[model samples]
Structure formats: C-alpha cells, structure tokens
Target chain A: MLSPGATIGVLGAGQLARMLALAAARLGFKTHVFAPSADEPAFDVCAARTIAAYDDPDALDAFARAVDVVTYEFENVPAATAEFLDARRPVRPNPRALALTQDRLVEKEFVQGLGVETAPFADVPDAGALARAVAKLGRPSILKTRRLGYDGKGQVAIRGGGDLGALFRALGGAPCILEGFIDFVKEVSVVAARGVDGEFHAYDISENQHENHILAETRAPAAILPETAVRAKEIARRIAEAEDYVGVLAVELFLVKSGRSERLIVNEIAPRVHNSGHWTLDGALTSQFEQHVRAIAGWPLGSTARLGRVTMRNLIGDDAERWPEIAAEDGACLHLYGKREIRAGRKMGHVTRIELE
Target chain B: MLSPGATIGVLGAGQLARMLALAAARLGFKTHVFAPSADEPAFDVCAARTIAAYDDPDALDAFARAVDVVTYEFENVPAATAEFLDARRPVRPNPRALALTQDRLVEKEFVQGLGVETAPFADVPDAGALARAVAKLGRPSILKTRRLGYDGKGQVAIRGGGDLGALFRALGGAPCILEGFIDFVKEVSVVAARGVDGEFHAYDISENQHENHILAETRAPAAILPETAVRAKEIARRIAEAEDYVGVLAVELFLVKSGRSERLIVNEIAPRVHNSGHWTLDGALTSQFEQHVRAIAGWPLGSTARLGRVTMRNLIGDDAERWPEIAAEDGACLHLYGKREIRAGRKMGHVTRIELE
Candidate 1:
C-alpha cells in the first residue's frame, strides 16, 4: 500500500484532474499532473506538474520515476503512453481498460461478453461495410467512430433520407460502429470503484440529462426502482471485476420502462471519474474522487452512503458567469475550474445543490 | 468584491495556511503562499509561492502586487509585515486585530471594554508590578507574557509559597500580565466569521480539551445549555463588531457552571482559524477555512449549519503514523499536513468523525 505522502501522477490536466488532485491532497497524497498544456486547470493545485506531450519518453520516464502510481483523467490516453508508464510504475485501472474503452466496437463487444445487455452493434470497416451495417441496423441508428470519440463528437445520426456515403465520408472514412438506438426512458449511471484487494463499492445511481450531447445536469438516487439501481450497480461491479479495475469508473446505462417491465441497456463505460458523479461531492459520505485515490493507493474503500437528494448542474461557458449568485444561494456548493477563456460548450465549472432529507 | 479567479496571498505556510489555500482553490481563487520556509506545508498546493523572510521588502512588494488580498494563518504576523501588506493590498480581519490579539493584556482589556466578562487581569511590566498584581489577584494566578505566547509557552503559575522572582526571571523578565484563574467546568470556543459587508455567522460552539497545554480534541455543540451557546455566540459577534474584523476568528471561553446558572469568561481570541473549528471541515455545511476565504474575498458567507455530532482529534507527532489504520476506519476523515519531520506536540494531521443523528 502506498503511504500517505506518496505522490500520484495524473495524466490530463483538465477539470477532472484538478478535482482528482484536490481529493488526493485531502487524503495526504501529493499529486504530479502531467499534461501537454502549460495552462491546464490542474496545475494550480498540484504538487508538481510536467508540461510535455503524452508520448514524450524522457518526460514520461521522469514522471513515472517521481510517482508511486499513475492514473489518468480521460479514457483516451495513448496506448503507448499507458504502456510506457505501466512498465515504469503501476498504471491504475490498467492499460487493458484504456484499450477496451477507447474503441466503441471493442467496448460494446466487451460489455456483451460479460452477459450485459448492450445496443445492437456492428463494425463498419469502410463505406461498403457501412452500407451493409446500415441495412442490418436500419436508419435512426448512430454511426460513431470506433476510436477517439467524446462529448457527442465523431458521431452522427443515420436519419432517413440522408446519404450514407456522404455521412461516411464526413467521418473521414474512419472505422465506425452502427448502434441501433434504444428508446431509453432515462439515462442513469453507476459510479463505482474496485480496490486491488478485490473490494467493490458503488455510489447511488445518478440520472443524467444532456444538452447538445454535453452533460447538463445529474440527480442522485436517480428516481428509479430500487431493484433497477441494484442491477445497475451489479453490472458495474461485474465490469470492474472483469477488467480488474483499480479506480473509480462509471457505467452509463439506458433505462427503458414499458408496461411495468424495466430493461437496462449498457451504453458506455467511463474508465475515470464521470461528470455525473460530481453530485457525490456534496451528496455522498465519500466523493468518487477521493474513492479513486483510495483505490489506486491500495487503501480500503470508503462508504458510498448518500447524504441527501442532490442535483449537480454543469456551468458551461457563460453559465459560470452567475457564480456570484450561485455562491450566495443557500446550500449551493460552487466549484469553478480555473480556465481563463470561456467558449460556448466549454465546461467552466459546476454547482451542486443538496437537499437533506 | 473579488471575483472567482482573484489571487489570495497567505502569510505563514503551516497546516493552517495549507488548509486555507485548499479552501481558496475550492472557491476558484488561486493562492500565493508567502513564508520563510522552503519546505512549508502550503507549498505543495498553491499557485505561487515566495520563500523569503516576512520583512523582505522586495518579496513582500511582489507578493502584494500579485494578490488581491492578504490574510495570515497566525496571529503573531509582525505588525510591520501586516502594515506593509495592508498598504499594498487589503488585509482581512485588519491589522488592528493582529495588534490586539498578539498581546494578552491588550486583548483582555479590549474584551473588558466591550462589557464582556474576562478573567481579572493586570499588566506587570516589572518584578515590582508583578508582585503587586499577584497580591491583588491572589495565589494560583497565571502570569503570561504580554506578547507572542502560545501553546502554554511563556507562562507560569503563581502558587502558594513559590519564588515569584524565579518565575519572573524564567520568563526572561518580559512584559507580562497576571490573570486571576477561574475554576471553570469546561473550555469552549466560538468559531465565527464576519463578512466584509458586516454580516456575522458563527458555527456551533465547540468543547475543547487540552493535553500538555496543546489542543487534543474538540467536540461540536459543546454539551452546553442553549442559552450559554447563544451567549457565547453573542460575545463573539460583539468582539468582531468591536474590532471591525473581517474573516474567521475564534473566541476561547471558560464555562463555569454554578447550580442552575452558568457564566462565561473570555479566555483568548484567535484572529485566524482555530484548531477547535477543525471539526467543521467534515461536520458543518461550510468549513471554517472556506468561510474565511469567502469573508476575505468579499463574497457571501456560507452556511454554518452543523451536519452531525462531530469529534476532531489532533494527530500529534507519532499519532499520524497510524494513518493506515485511520484510513481504514469506516467514517473517519483523515487529513495529514505535508510536514517532513514530526516532533513531539507538533501537529502532523487531524482526524474527524461525524455521527449522524
């Protein structure tokens, strides 16, 4: 087990890394954030920061030698970077998790292999194969890049009367997956952690809302059936066990309810802290950030007890300009990412309101 | 009012400043820590740090220019240093608070002037005055240095038939004050904040216990009568108003219960965050450190609502080595200062346990 003073090296220095560094500091672990950007948000609060490309061998070697373990804020960490760090020091959640989640087709196949229900998916290697997959899956499905997709990027809807060839060319002829859409009543996620000792703990399910394919809000307890919540957590646990994951991860699921029957379809798995889990910062006994640190450090997992009915809203772009009003609101906890420029669709900060019952 | 991204300059880089900087980061303010030690705890988690003597004019000028406001972690900030920073930028709780609390005689006199009860005190500038004060206050009184006394340092007890001359010489013939000792049933403190807009808020009273004259533990709500708690808060409010203080301050009081009636004596006032308020970090809706940052930033004061029954124990010296066991505890929140060496009685970290009702 890593001692209290051991340093954890974090890849990607965005808001996720910033919050992770803050949580690590609270747990007495120093954080060294390694990012390509000199003005990344996490640098303000970390013990050390290395500004270099992910594939920079010298920088990666020095960062690996300086930290006891390595973790990343984003799932799309370069395969080579993860392998390099893993050889020098333990890279938590493992490179296997990165390889699995980075590709859409691979992630869906892995979830299906675990006996978890996922949307109908078929890999399209080229435009001809895309036409075959489109014939098989039908219009209204989603054509998403197999790799390097985030925040609704690198994906397009296959609506009726659209040219499949044009759409395929628009995605730059990249390998893609056509997923048959599910009419989900709500989108819920299970944010959970698994320790090296094989201990598992999951927070209460969070119901999420997306605006323009960017997460806008999340409410904990999810307003779902207790059994559905249990099943969702079980799916997360199974995924963590199968991956031998050793940090906080989130499993997004589509909840479809009709005529007193409920079904869950596995949507995606985030191998790092999810924006939906942000509500746990104010509403749970132990936050997911702190839980990830604890898991990576080989410490015992903390209680995932929910403290209240909580809602977290992402302050995108100009939404953060109202921080003064939010901070003045009773029971509202405001967190601002130290980003100087505010552009539309950029996540500037977040605010969480918790109502104790 | 200072905006979210404004910088907060903190004096002293011990655990208090470390925590203050952490809180400032949470509120979206960057912190620049100024201290004489290169290895101070706050250096690990600040945006900028200047390692120089308090009176270094060039460093102080640069630090003042870099930050929007200045605050300190300790009360003994040299009056000259406070004055220098105050001239360049606003210093919260104001320099008058530093001058008042740094001297025991002045603090007691000021409290008394506000019609608040304090232990009867008399200034003893010399041996003859010490004898006269002892005669007036009687035996078993305490003679403490007028300036720079902390953690039971620079003080002696005047008992029945002891050498007053020796005790006087032991204190290096410094300016002292003789205070009549009160036979109190308990020691309690009110940790409170006054915003720049003159708004006052106080956390629930905390009952404290000392070991070797250093704070050992603190429990919130203090197991005191409701009226006593109200009166204690009122005293704190009065003191803050009298001093025109801004930022969090702590008022330590002696509670003496006689039959159905209770009396409170102002013992001392801490111009910065107090050890007694550490429980608020996990047990209150808003932590003392965060509250101090809000006050100093000219922002709205956060709620002081207690979340649960809370107990905080200081991990002194070797006590922090049991961090592994502490981290494994079900509901304990552990915080360790990044101090390299641990000496006996030196605070290394703290653990807080909250029992929800």
Candidate 2:
C-alpha cells in the first residue's frame, strides 16, 4: 500500500481534481496534478504540477517518475496516456475500466451483459444507418455520439419529421447511438468504491435534478423504496466487480414507475467520482473523494454511514457570486472552485446543507 | 473585504497553517505561505511560498506584495517582521494581539483587566525577583520564561526548596513569569473568532488533557456545568473584544472546583488556532481553520453547530504509525501532518472519533 507522504498524480485540473487533491492532503499524501491548463483549480492545492499535453510522452515519463500512483478525475482521459503511465507506475481503476466507460455504446452493452436493464438502443454509424435506427426506435429518440460527450454536448434529439441527413450532420456524422427515451419519475445515482482486496462500499443513493442538462441539485437518501436503493447499489457493485475497478465509480440510473411497481434502468456509468455524490463530502462519515483515494492506495474501505439528510446545490455560472450569502447561512457548507472567469452554465462551486438525523 | 480569488499570506508553515491553506482554497482563496523551512506541511497545498527567515526584509516585502492579508499560525512572529508586512498589507489579529500573547505576564494582565480571573503571577527579570514571588505565591509554582516558551520548554516547576539563583540561571536568565499553582480540576479552552465588524462566534468548549505539557486529547461539550460553559464563552468574548481580535483565538482556562461551584481562571491566550479546536474539523459545521480564514478575510462567520460528541487524539511520534488501523476504524477520521521524521515529542498527526447525537 502507498503510505502517507507518497505523491499522487491526478490527470485532470478541474474541480473534481481539486477536491481529490484536498482530500489526499488530509490523509498526508502530496498530489501532483498533470494537465495542459496553465492554472486550473486543482493546481492551487497540489504539491507539484505539470502543464503539458496528455499525448506528450516526455511529460508523462516525468509525472510517472514523480508520483507513486496515477489516477484521473475524468474518464475521457486518453487511453494512450493511461497506458504510458501504467507502464511505469500503477494507473488506478485501470485502463480497461477507462476504455469501457469512455464510449457510451460500450458502457451500455457492458451493463446489459451483466443482466442489468437498459433503454432500447441501436448503433448509427452513418446517415443511412441513422435513418434505419430512427425507423426502428421511433420518433423522439436521442442521437448521441458514442465518444466524448458530456453535459448534453455532442447530442441531438430526432423529433417529428426531422431529416436524417441534417440530424447526422449536426452530430458531425460521428459514430453514434440512438436510444428511446424513458419517462423516468426520478434520476438517481449510486457512488461506490472497490478496494484492491475486492471489498466494496457504497454511499447512499442521491436523487438528482438537472438544469440546462447540467447537474443542479442532489438530495441523498433519495425518496425511493429501500429495495430499489438496494438494487441500485447492487448494480454498482456488479459493475465494479466486472470492471475489476479499484476506485470510486458512479452509476446513474433512471427510475420509472411501471404498473404500480418501480423499475430502475441503467442510464450511464462514470468511471470516476460523479457530481451526484458531492453531498457525501459533508453528509457522510467518509467522502467519495477520500474513498477513491483509499481504494486507489490499496487501503481498507471506510464506513459509508450517512451523517444526516443532505441537500447539495451546484452553483453554476453567476450562482457562485452568492458565496457571501451562502457562507452566512446557518449550517451551510460552501465549496467554491477557484475559477476566476464566470462563464454561463459553468459549475463554479457547490453548497451542501445537512439536517442531522 | 478580501475577494474569493485573493491571496492570503500565512506565516509559519506547520500543520495549523497547512489546514488554514486548505480551508482557504475551499473558499476560492489562494494562499502564499512564508516560512524559513523548505518543506513544511503548508507548502504542500499553497499557491506560492517563500523560504526565508522572518528577519529578511526582502522576503517579507515579496510576501506582502503577493497576498492581500497577512496572518500567522504561531504567536512568536517577531515584532519587526509583523511591522514590515503590516506596512504593505493588513496583518490580521493585529500585531498588538501577538505582542500581548507572546509574553505570558502581559497576557495575564490583559485578561485580568477585563474582569477575568487569572492565577496570581509575578514577573521575574532577575534572581532577586524570583525569591519574592515564590514567598508570596507559595510552593509548587511554575517558573516559565516570559517569551518563546511552548510544550513545557523554558519552564521549571518549583518545589518546597531549591536554590533561587540556580533556578534563574537554568532558564538562561530570560525574563520569566512565576504562576502560582491553582489546583485546577480540569483544563478547558474556548476557541472563537471575531470579524472585522466586531461580530463574535465561539465553538462549544473543549475539555483538554495534556501529557508532558503537550496537548494529548480533547473532548467537546466538555463535561462541565451548562452555566459554567456559558460563563466560559462570556469570558472568551470579553477577552477577544478587549484585544480587538480579528481572527481565531483560543483561550485556555483552568477549571477549579470551588466548593459546589466551578470557577474558571484564564490560564493563557493563543492568538491563533489551537490544538484543542482540531476536533471541529470533523465534528462541527465550521472548523476553526475555516473560521479563522473567514474572519481574517472580512467574511461572515459560519455556524458553529456541533455535529456530535467528539474525541480528538494527537498522534505524537510513533502514534501516527497506526494510520492504517485508524483508517480502517469505523467512523474514525484520521489526519496526518505529513512530517517525514517521527521524532519523539513531535506532533505527527491527529484522529477524531465522533458519536453522532
């Protein structure tokens, strides 16, 4: 196991990486963040940092030599980058897990192969294929690029009387998947971790809300049946075991009401700590970031007991300007990512408010 | 008021400074640490650092230029260094507070002037003064150097008989304060913060236990009468107001049982975060580190609500070697200071265990 004082190399320099670096520091580990950005939020807290492209082998070599283990905040990290680091130092969650989750089509098939339910989907390689898939899946289906999609990007909806050629052109004619939409009553996610010893622990489920296709709010101990919550966590555990994952992974699911019974459909899989689990930072005995660090370091998993009923709100765009107000609010825990520029729809920070049980 | 993106200048690069830097980053503030040590714990998480002795004017000038406000983790910051920085930028908790607390005799006088009770103390500038003070205060007294003493250093306990001249010589002939033993039943401390607007907030009192004159353990909601606790907070507020404090300060008190009534005698004041308040990191809504940052930045103080019953244990020397076991303990929060060498009597890390109420 990597001991305290060991340097951890994180691949991204976004807020997720920032929080991970802080959590690692709490455990006495120094983090070295590697990203191309000259000054990202994560750089402020890390012990060392490298401003270099992911494909630069020389930079990767230096980073590998400096850190005891390598991990990433985002799953879209290049496969070649992970492979190069793995050759010298251990890359946590492994390259195989990254490959499986980076592409939407592969992730869905992997979940289905494990006997988990998913929406009806078809591959659309070109305009002609899109036409056929649309015919099969019916109108009002979402056509999303199989790779490099996040925050409702690289996607378009095929609604009544839309030209297949234009629709395919809108997505740049990239390889894609067309899936029928489910009228889900609620969207929930299970954030879980797996250790090197194969022990698994999962935080309570978080029911999520999206605004402009970006995560806006999350409430833990989601208002769902206990059995449904159990099933959600079980699906996350099965996926982690199948991937042989050794870090925190989040599985987002759509819960639909069917004939007075509840059904959960696996929507997507995130190979890193997801935003839905941010509430765990304040409301759980162990935060998801710390759990990820422990799992990657080959340590035992910590308790996942809930500390309170939690509500987390993301401060997108100008929302973070209210930091003063939020800071004054009684019992409010405000976390602001050090992003100077205020762009529209950008996630600048978040606040977690908890009601003790 | 310092904006979220402003840089905070922290003096002394120890674990207390390390924690303050982390908390500042959470609020989107960058920290520039100034210290003589090259690899102190605070350097691991700060945006920039200066490694120069406190007496170096050039280093102080650069640090002042880089940060919006200046603060220190320890009260021993030299007078000239603080004045140098205060000329260029604001020095928080003010230099007067540091100067007062640095000298035990001066701090006791200040506390007593506010109608707060303190143990009888006499200044000893020479061997002759020591004899007179001993005769008045009686036996079993503590003779501590007036300045630059910590963790039992620079102090000697006097018994029934001893050579007065030898005792003064043993202390290097430095000015001293001889305090009469009060026979305190318990040691409790109040860690609180005051804002620029004269607003004050205090955490629940913590009962402290010391080993070899170093803080070893702390229990929050210290087993004291409710009225005594309220009175303790009142005494702390009076002290902070009298000092015009603008940051976190810890007031150490001696709880002496006075025949069915408990009386608190102000023992000392630390003009920075204290070890006894470390439990707030995991057991309270606002940690002392975070509270200090807010007060120094001119931001509103956060809620001081306690999460549960908390017990904090300091990991001195080899105590940190049990990190693996503590990390695996259910609901235990372990924090290591990342000190490379585990020398005896050195503070290595700490752990907080909470029983939720």
Candidate 3:
C-alpha cells in the first residue's frame, strides 16, 4: 500500500491531472506530472513535473522510479507506455482496464459479456462490412472510430439516404463500430470506486446534459426512478468486480422511459474520474478525486453520501469570464483550471452549488 | 485592482502562505513567496520564491517589483519591509494594522481607543512597574512582551508571591503589557473581510481552545449568546473601518458570562487570517483563505454562510501521523503543510469536519 508521503506519477497533464494532483496533495501525497507540454495546467500545482513526451524513455524511467504508483489522467496512454511503467511500478486502474476502454468494440463486448445491456453495435472494417453493419443496425446509427474517440469526436451520424460507401471512405476506412441509436429519456452515470480491499462505494446517480456533444451540466441524485438508479449502481458494481478495478470508474447509462417504467442501457465505462462526478467536490461527503486517490493507495473507501441537492455546470470557453460574478455569489464554488488560453469548446473551469432543502 | 494573471507577493513562507498560494492559484493568480528560510513550506507550491532575509533590500526590491500586491502570513513583518513593498505595490490590511497588532500594548491601546472593551492593561517597563501594575490589577495578571511573542512564548503568569524581578528579567526586559485576567466563559473570534469596494462579510464566530497557548481546536457557530456574537462582529467591522483594511481580519474576544447576561472583551486583532478561522476551509460557503485572497485582489467578498456545524483541529507534531486514518474517514478533510519534519509543538497540518444536522 502506498503511504501518504509517496509520490504519484500521472501520465497526462490536463485538467483532470491537475485536479488529481491537488487532491493527492491534500492526502499528503506528491504528484509528478509527465507531459510533453511545457505549461500544462497540472504542472502549475504539482510538486514535480517533467516536460517530456510520452515516448521519452528516460523521462518515463525516472518518473516510474520516483513514484510508488502510476496513474493516467486519460485513457489514450499508449499501450507501450503503460507496459513500460507497469514493469517499473504499479499502474492502475491497471493496463487491462485501459486496453478494454481504449477501443469501442472491446468495451461494448466486455460490458455485454458481463450480462449488462448495451446499445446494439456492429464492427465495420470496410465498405462491404459497413454496408452489412448498416443493414444489421439500421440507417440511423453512429459510425464511430473503434479507437481515439472522445467528446463526440471522430464519429459521424448516419441518417436515411446517407451514402454508406462515401461515409466509409470519408472516415479513411478505419475500423469502426456502428451503434444503433437509442431513444434515451436522459443520460445518467454512476461514478463509483473499488478499493484495494475490493470494497465498492458509489455516489448518487448523476443526470448529465450535453450541449454540442460536450457535457454542459451534471445534477446528482438524478431524477430517475428509484429502481433504475439501483440497477445502475448494480451494473457498476458487477463491472468493477469483473474487471477487478482498483480505482474510480464511471459508467454512463441511457435511461429509457416506457409507460412509467425505466430501463437503463450501458453507454460506456470511463476508468478514471468523470466530469459528471465534479459535483462531489462540494456536494458529497468525499470528492471523486479524493476517492480515486484513496482507492489507488489501497485505503478504505470513504462515504458516498450526497451532502445536499447538488448541481455542477462546466465553464466552457468564455463562460469562465463570469468568474468574478460567480465568486461573489453565495454558495457557488468556482474552480478554474489554470489554462493560458480559453479556446472554443475547451473546458476552462467548473462551478458547483449545493442547495439544502 | 489586480487581475487573475497578476502576481501576489507573500512575506512569510509557512503553512499559512502555502494555503494562501494554493487559494491564489485556484483563482488563476501566481504567487511569489519572499522568505529567508530555504526550506519554507510555501516554496513547494508557489510559482516563484526568493530566499533572503526581509531586511535584504536587493531581494525585497526584486520581490516587490515581481508582484502586483503584497500580503503577509504573519503580523511580525518589519515595518521597513512593509514600507519598502508599499511604495511599489498595494499592501492589503495596510502596514499600520500590522504595526498596531505587532505589539500587545499598541493593540490594547488601539482597541480601547476605539471605545472597544479589552482586558484592563497597564504598561510594565521594569520590576517596579510590574509590582505597581500587579498591585493595581490584583493577582493573576498576564505579563506579556509588547512585541515578538506567540504560542505561549514571551509571557508569564503572575500569581501571589511570584518572582516579579526574575520574571521581568527572564522576558528579556523588553517593553511589556500587564493585563488583568478576565473571568471569562469562552474564547471566541470573529473573522471578517472588507473588500476594496467597502463591502464587509464576516463568518460566524468560532469558539477556540488553546493548548500551550497554541490553537488546538475551533468550533464554528460558537456556543455564545446571539447578541454577544453580533457585538463581536460589530467590533471587527469597526476595527476594519478604522484601519481602512482591505483584507481579512480576525478579532479574538473573551466572552464573560455573568449570570444570564453575557459580555465580550476584545483580546487582540490578527491583521491576517487567524488560526481560529481554519474551520472556514470546509465549514463555510467560502473559506477564510479564499476570502482573504479575494479581498486582497480587490474582488468581491464571498458568502460567509456556515455550511453546517463544523470543527477544525490542528495536528501538531506526531498528531500528523494519524493522517492515514483521518484520510479514510468519511467527511474529514485533512490538510497537511508540506513541512519536512514534525518537531514537538510544531503545527504540521489540520483537519476540518462539517457535521450535518
């Protein structure tokens, strides 16, 4: 088990890594962020940082030797990088969890194989396979790259009269998955954690809203049927147990309402802290970031009780310009990622509010 | 007004500066700590730090030129240091406030001059004056050095048959104040802030318990009479206005319960964040550290609403060894100063817990 003064090596240096570093610091652990960018947001607050590329062997070796454990901020860490670090130090949510979530087909298959419901999906390798998959999944499906897709990127929506051959060629004939669209009443997720002792704790379900395919808001204690929420928690538990997950995991679900009945379909599993869990910063007994640190350190799981009715909103782009106003407001907790520039569609910060009823 | 990208120069490099830097970073501001200690705790988290004595003019000039404003973690900043920086950048809480609080006699005089009640005090310069003052004030008076005293140091209790000359000689024979003891019920403090725009916000009073003259625990929404708490707030407001203070200030009070009626006597003012206000980190809508940063930056004061019944306990020396257990607790928020060693009576970290009713 990693102790309080141990070092944590983070693979990426984005906002997630920054928040994780801050959380780790609060737990008496130091963070060493290794990223190619010179001024990644995470570097600003970390105890140590190496401005080196992921493939830089010397930097990776030094980082691994310095830290007691390794973790990645995002799922796109190269397989070779993970293997290299795993040889030197413990890397978790483990390389297997990363490998499973890095690809679309593998993730869906793994979830479904665990007796969990997922959206119907078919692999399309070429034009002929695309046509076959189109016929099998119907025209109103999304053709997403089997790898490297995030925030609605690297995916194209197919409707009636959309050319299958042209669409396949447009995506450069990369291996892809065709997912049949589900009429989701609401998008919800369970941000849960598995401790080193295999104890699982899940926060209240969070309902998410996406604007321009980017998360806009997340509300905890999601206004979903009680049974559906329970089922969502169970799905997360089974997935964590099946994977032997040792850190925070987020399972996104599509809630379908039918005649006063609710059904949940597994959308995806994120093997790291989820944006929807941001509300935990102020609205829950323990934040998801802190939970992730504890789980990775082989510590006991903290309480998952929601403190009050909580709402979290992403401050995308210029929305962060209202920080002065937000900071002045009562009960508004504003967190700004120290990003130099605020580009369009970039998440600059977030605000969390807890309302006591 | 300093903007987000501006720099803040801090005088002290202790845990308070470490916390202030962290708070400033959250608002996208960089911090530059000027301290003589090479192993200053704040150096690990700040963007820049200068290692030189406060009297080093060259280092002070460079530090003052590097930041947009100046603030200190403690009130003992040499008057020359404050003046040197004040000529270059704005200094919040102003140097006069520091001068007033740095000496026990000056602080007592200032409070009484404002028509605020304080423990009856008399200037004691030598053995003769000490005897005379004790005779006038009666037994059980506190003889404290006028300057450079903290955490039970530089003070001696005078009871019947005590060695007055030896006690006076032991205290370095510096200027001192002899304060008559108050038969009080509790020690509480009001932490409040005044923004540049003249807006004032105060967190609820916190009941403080001291061990060896160092703060041990603080409970927010102090168990005191409602009118007495209001009077404490009013006294703080009056002091802030009198000083034209533009940042957080803490006023310690002695609550004397005589019959069903309760009255308050001013103890001393901390021209910066007080240890008693540490509970605000997790117990209030806005933490005292963040509020200080905001007030110093000429921004809006955040809400001081209490989140719940909250308690903060300082972890001194070996107490920090319990960090692992504290981290595992459900709602406990533990914060450790990145100090290297845990010397006896040294404050290494603190933990804040908010209890929901």
TM values, all candidates: 0.99, 0.99, 0.97
**Tens digits of per-residue lDDT for model 3 on B1-357?**
666768888999998888888788777777899999877678767778899999999999999888999999999999999988898889887999889999898888888889999999999977889998998999899999999998899999998896899999889989889999999888999999999988998999999998888999999889988888889999999999988998999999999987899898998889998899989877776789889999999888887878789999999989998887887787788888877788999998999988886
The DockQ-based CAPRI class assigned to model 2 is high
Tell me the tens digit of each residue's lDDT in model 3 across A261-323. Answer: 999999988999989999998787678988898898888877787878999999999998888
Model 3 chain A weakest lDDT span, ten residues long: A21-30
Candidate 1 interface RMSD (Å)? 1.0
Query: How big is the positional error of residue A104 in model 3, measured in Å on the Cα after superposition?
Result: 0.9
TM-score of 2: 0.99
Estimate the TM-score for candidate 1: 0.99
> For candidate 3, what is the TM-score?
0.97
DockQ of each: 0.74, 0.84, 0.57
lDDT of 1 by residue, A107-140 (tens): 9999999999999999988988888998898878
Model 2 lDDT at residue B128: 96
> Who wins the DockQ comparison?
2
Q: Comparing candidate 1 with candidate 2, which one achieves the higher DockQ? A: 2
**After superposition, candidate 1 runs with Cα above 4 Å error:** none
The runs of at least 3 residues in candidate 2 whose Cα sits more than 4 Å from the true structure, single-residue gaps closed, are: none
Clashing pairs in 3: none
